[model samples]
Target: MKIGVVSDTHLSDRREIRLPQELLGGLSGVELILHAGDWISPRVAEELEKLAPVEGIAGNNDGMDIVSRFGYKKIVEAAGVRIGLIHGDGYGKTTERRAFDAFEGQDVQAIVFGHSHIPYLERKAGILLFNPGSPTDKRRQLLYSYGIMEIREGEITAVHHYYASWD
Candidate 1:
């Protein structure tokens, strides 16, 4: 299964970029899409759904309605692998580790989150934690980025795709 992962698209009318070509183009052949949050607008969600089936959670900037409708987190079993998704508030407190703790008693192979708008892929305490970064909103001179996860036979491998300046 191919999973398209994205986060922190802080889109608004004032924001110059909405979604980039890298992300829209990369959606090809994806079985499902995961948006870790900070979508900032409902239109973004609507557009994303057109690419593939989407599972999303609301970020801190998301209004109450979005949060109430979307929930703070999501967990699903796909391709025989259990995956956890969250928008990851509590930024400076090691949100990744805290997410693991939140699901401490649950069964999950990996947890995905986004809040700092920085892409990260690493294993902590034998559990995989990832952040796809902000596809539209780059922070601290970071490049725009997204991620893809290939799952087969219940195992998952992920790759981060960042937008080049030329693009």
Candidate 2:
């Protein structure tokens, strides 16, 4: 199965929010979409659902309505792999560690999180940690990025898809 992963889409009522065309194009053949959070509007999920089913958590920037619909964390099982999802927040100097700790006791093959608005993908202690970064808002990064995961049997391979411009 192919999955598209994204995060930190900080869209609000005050600003025009549109998914990056590169993101939508990259997700063309995906079967599922996982949003790590910071989706300020539920419409973001709605838009993504037009392409594929979306599973997401609420980020710190999300409002009460989003928090009520989707909490801060979730766990999903697909292709025999258990994936932990969280919109990591409140860890001063050890954000990655805190994200990993969020699913500590759980038997997860991977953990997906976003908060720093930085793209990250690493394997530690037999678990894959992935953060797709922000496709619409690249705070300090040079490029906008998202993630793609291919799962088969019990193994998973993930990669980042980056573009210099949203256009």
Candidate 3:
């Protein structure tokens, strides 16, 4: 299965709103989409669902409506892989450790998280820690980015799709 991973969209309620075309293009043809949160608006998921089925959690910036609807953590099974999803909050410089703790004692093969808007991919202690970054808001980063993961035959490969800028 091919899965598109994105986070920290930070979209607003403007009716004229639209997602970055580059981000949308990169996500094309994926079997599923995983959002790590900070969507800010439900419309983000609604729009993403047009491309593929979406599973997501709420981030720190999310409003009560969103938080109540999506919560802060999720575990999903896809393509014979167990995936943990969360929007890493607090811990300042130690966000990664907090993310790991969120799924501690679980049998997850991968953990997808977001908050710092910096793309990250690492394998630690036999678990894949993936942060797709912010396709719409790169924050201090030099480029906007997202992630893609392919799972087959009990193996998983992840790659980041980076763009110099978003128009």
All models, RMSD in angstroms: 2.1, 1.1, 1.2
For 1-167, candidate 1 gives per-residue lDDT tens digits of 99999988888645444567778988878989988888878678788888898888899898776687678888867798888888878744676666667677778898889888878899866667889887787878458889999898878888999886534
Score candidate 3 by TM-score against the native: 0.96
Stretch of 10 with least lDDT, candidate 1: 12-21
Candidate 1 achieves a global lDDT of 0.82
* Candidate 3, 1-167: lDDT as tens digits: 99999999998897545888998999999999999999999989899999999999999999988888788999988899999999999865566778888999999999999998989899989999999999999989999999999999977778999998766
lDDT of each: 0.82, 0.90, 0.91
In TM-score terms, candidate 1 sits at: 0.90
Question: Candidate 3: lDDT of 30?
Answer: 99
**Alpha-carbon error at 92 in model 3, in Å?**
5.9
- For model 3, what is the error of residue 43's alpha carbon versus the real structure, in angstroms, after optimal superposition? 0.4
Off by over 4 Å in 2: none
Give residue 119's error in model 3 in angstroms: 0.5
